[model samples]
Structure formats: structure tokens, C-alpha cells
Target: MGEPSHEATTAPQEDLSSEATTTARGNHAEELTGAAAMFANDRASQHLGITVDDHGPGWAQCSMTITDIMANGHEITHGGYIFLFADTTFAMACNYPGSTTVASGGDIDFLKPTYVGDTLVARGKEIVKQGRSGIYDIEVTRGEEIVAVYRGRSRTLPARKPTTSDAAAPPVPTSP
Candidate 1:
């Protein structure tokens, strides 16, 4: 009928959903773990008692227990502490072993108050990545209740010139 439609003549289309699935599976486990560990030792995070609980290619989780030092005059955890926890998670999620990522900008919304001895957990996930720019969202929670939310914009730096020491080191295995 009318010389077979062009749409019918085209080859079967590839599944678009598979592209997202494939990207999700691109996580390098070893690199993710190594990066999380390195971030755990950051001076500010360390000083604030932040610990990285998990991370992947575009996701991360970190936690901090509110101590006396983190409390404000009102006896509630300072907003800055909550923001730091979320920021650290965002940083860890955006960075990998060979590439450096920095925050171009970010903002936070404080939803609830956190008190001393409360353990706050911040989970960060990548919203999108196009070319060199990316967006991340972080949720800060105390137990089952959300305390704050943060949005961060990131830019990945160009590949660095490898030094002799770096060039000599073996690539970290993606699998355990």
C-alpha cells in the first residue's frame, strides 16, 4: 500500500532505556571505594567527624554525628555542619580517580533542626551530566526525618599531565 512506509522499512530501533541501564552499570567499584576513602580523610570532613558510608559512579553517602563542637548557642546543631556533610557527599559523588571535579555553585535549604548526638546522613546523587558540567542533589536526614536538601553544580577539570610516578603506577582494577 503506497510503496511500504519509510518508518516500516527502517531497522528495529535500539532500546533507549538500555542506554540509561548501561550508564548506571558503568560504575567502577574499586575507583569508587578508593575515592570515598580518600575523601573520608579530608581535613575538614575529618575534623567535623564526617564519614563516608558509600559511593559509586554518581552517588555517595556520608554521615556526621553532632557533637558539642557542632552545636550552636541554641543547643541545636549548627546549619553549617549540616551543609558541610551534604557538600562532602556531593564532592565525593562528582569526583573519580583520574578526573577532578569542583563545585561551580551550590545552595542549601534547612528544613529541620538537628541536635547534639544526632547522627545526620547525607546522600548525594547525580541529576545530570553533559559535557563538562553536571548537577547533583543531596538530601540530609536524621534517621527517618529529612533535615536539609542541597543542590550543587559541578564542572570536571580536563585531564592532568601525568607525572612519572603516576605513569608508572598500575591502573586500579575495576573489579575486586
Candidate 2:
């Protein structure tokens, strides 16, 4: 309808070769315990309005409502939003009760169109976990119908410095 509700945005991948060596090895014993805590700094997920419905060892469920801002040129939900929803669930499933994990690569198939105001739920499950790598499958559904499927490959990052809730500390002072 109106110039494709929300245009998708992507960021360049970060190079952490140096920071990885130091932080990954130092904080092994202190990773966050829950999805909310572990992803408190996930601005991308937060900005997209995705919410965790449930999560536990090797499994996660998340949901998002397709707003006008999330529709594409055809007035249906954008494929990127669906992928983001699935990816978020995959991350939660892979990292529960473990160190940080990131998607190494992923693929998706769109099965049906989703419309504005539709509430889409994404469910993720670990298909396999070996050594430092894992495979996850995610299904995106609306009510009783399937909308998309996503498969992701994940690799656990070496534990990094512990993260704390920003609310737990005083705001850093800024120079006037």
C-alpha cells in the first residue's frame, strides 16, 4: 500500500578476531542465564518488536504481529521480517544455558503470504549439536497454517566478558 511498510536494513558483519581471543576465553563461567538477559543488548530484535513466547534447552518460540510498517510492496508481510523472526528463535534455542552462539549461515523458504495484523509465531528446535556447532530448524506459522521454514547453522562463540543489565548501573557520564 504505502511504499512498502518497512524497508529492511542490514549491517556489515563485525570482525572480532582480536576481541574474540581475549573476551571469549575470560568469561566462560559467567554467561547470562535466560533469553531475556542474554539478549538484552540485542537492538535488532528489539527494534523489530519480536517477543519471546517460550524457550528452554534446545527449543524456543517467538512471535511478532505484522504491522503496517512490516508489510512489503504487495501489502503482505516482508520476507525479511519472517527471516528475522525465525533467526531470533534459532539464536534463543541454540544458546539457552550455554555460552553465546551466533548464526554461521542459514536458509529459508517462504511457503505462504502473511498479511498485516496477522500474528506469526516461529518455533525453533535443535536438529543436532556436535562439538561447537549446532543445526536448528524453525517453522513460521500463522494460526494453523505454515508460512515459512528456516534452517540455521550456529557456532558458539568463546565466552566473552560478562554482560550486565544496563539498568543495573549508573549511566556513564558524558562530557558537557
Candidate 3:
């Protein structure tokens, strides 16, 4: 197979650009709603240069280019980075506007070694969601080649009543 290009191979540039625009605009208007809003404050994913390409009610797609910093002693991309990518995608899929969902557990199977400069796209889809629990499947790909598959279990946290301290504290201001 040919080497994967640095450009996204799954979604077209126009589509990805449009989605990015929508996310940016949404951030300005809502600032604290939906998966896009949740991702806005995600320092870890942002630090790793992971971008959320698309997301909706039950699915999300994100991409990250493997950098030299991500490489292990043997020079291949480390497994933790791949897992983090997939886990972030899974988080985007299961979270909604009003709820906070966290990964209960996840497991990944690496199918191939990933090298520095390789751009990997992780697509996550909700397999099932019942009550407060959900199952998601994420596939990590380089071009059309599958590199890893991750299965994630999620649990939506129960809404907690405001404590006396919370009631006494002033509301934190959100960024515009």
C-alpha cells in the first residue's frame, strides 16, 4: 500500500474545514454546550494536536499526527498515545449537552506499528447505550489501513445536588 498522505484521507478538506468552522462558531455562541464545547477545554488532546473532525449524537471522528515526541524507544508511536486518541474520540461520542460521561474502562488491540509523521484518524460509534451505561467502538486508521481497534465502556455521572458550599459560591463565568 502507498504511504498515507499528511492530508486527511477519510473526510474531504472542505467537509473537515466546514465542520471546524461550525465548531469554532459554536464555541463563541454557546461556549458550554455539546461535545464541541467539552472539547474546547480539553488540554490534553489539544496538547497532542488531536482535532475533533466531526461529532453528533452517537459518533465522533478525531485525528492526530504522530510526532517524534510520541515515539517510544524503538521509534514507533507508543500504545498510550493511540489509546488516548481513541479514548478521546469515545468521550466525544457519548457526551451530550447536559450530561457528563466518563470512561469506565477501555481496551485496545494494536494491529500495526505507527510511525512518526503518520496521521491517524480515530472514528468512534456508539454500539449500545442503556440507562447510564454505554458501549462504544473506535477504530484507528492510517489512510485506509486499520491500525487499532478500541472498545470503550462509559458511564454518565449522576447529577449531584448542589451542596451548601456550591450554593454559597458565586457562579463561575464562562469564556465568550
Lowest lDDT 10-residue stretch of candidate 3: 1-10
Models ranked on TM-score: 3, 2, 1
lDDT of 3 by residue, 1-176 (tens): 12222222232222323544454343232334546556755668878988877777678888999999999999999999999999989988888766778899999999999999999999888899999999999999999999999999999999757777767756655657
Better TM-score candidate (1, 3): 3
Off by over 4 Å in 1: 1-34, 37-41, 162-176
Q: For candidate 2, write residues 22-62 as lDDT tens digits.
A: 33333332323435335444568867778766677677878
* Candidate 3 local lDDT, residue 9: 20
Return the TM-score for candidate 3, rounded to 2 decimals.
0.77
Q: In terms of TM-score, which candidate is strongest? A: 3
State the lDDT of candidate 1 residue by residue for 5-32, as single tens digits: 1111011122323432233333322322
Residue ranges of candidate 2 with Cα displaced over 4 Å: 1-31, 161-176
For model 1, name the residue pairs that clash. none
TM-score of each: 0.71, 0.72, 0.77
What TM value does model 2 have?
0.72
Candidate 1 lDDT: 0.71
Q: Which regions of candidate 3 fall more than 4 Å away from where they truly are?
A: 1-30, 169-176
**Top lDDT prediction, candidate number:** 3
Root-mean-square deviation (CA) per prediction: 14.1, 11.9, 8.0
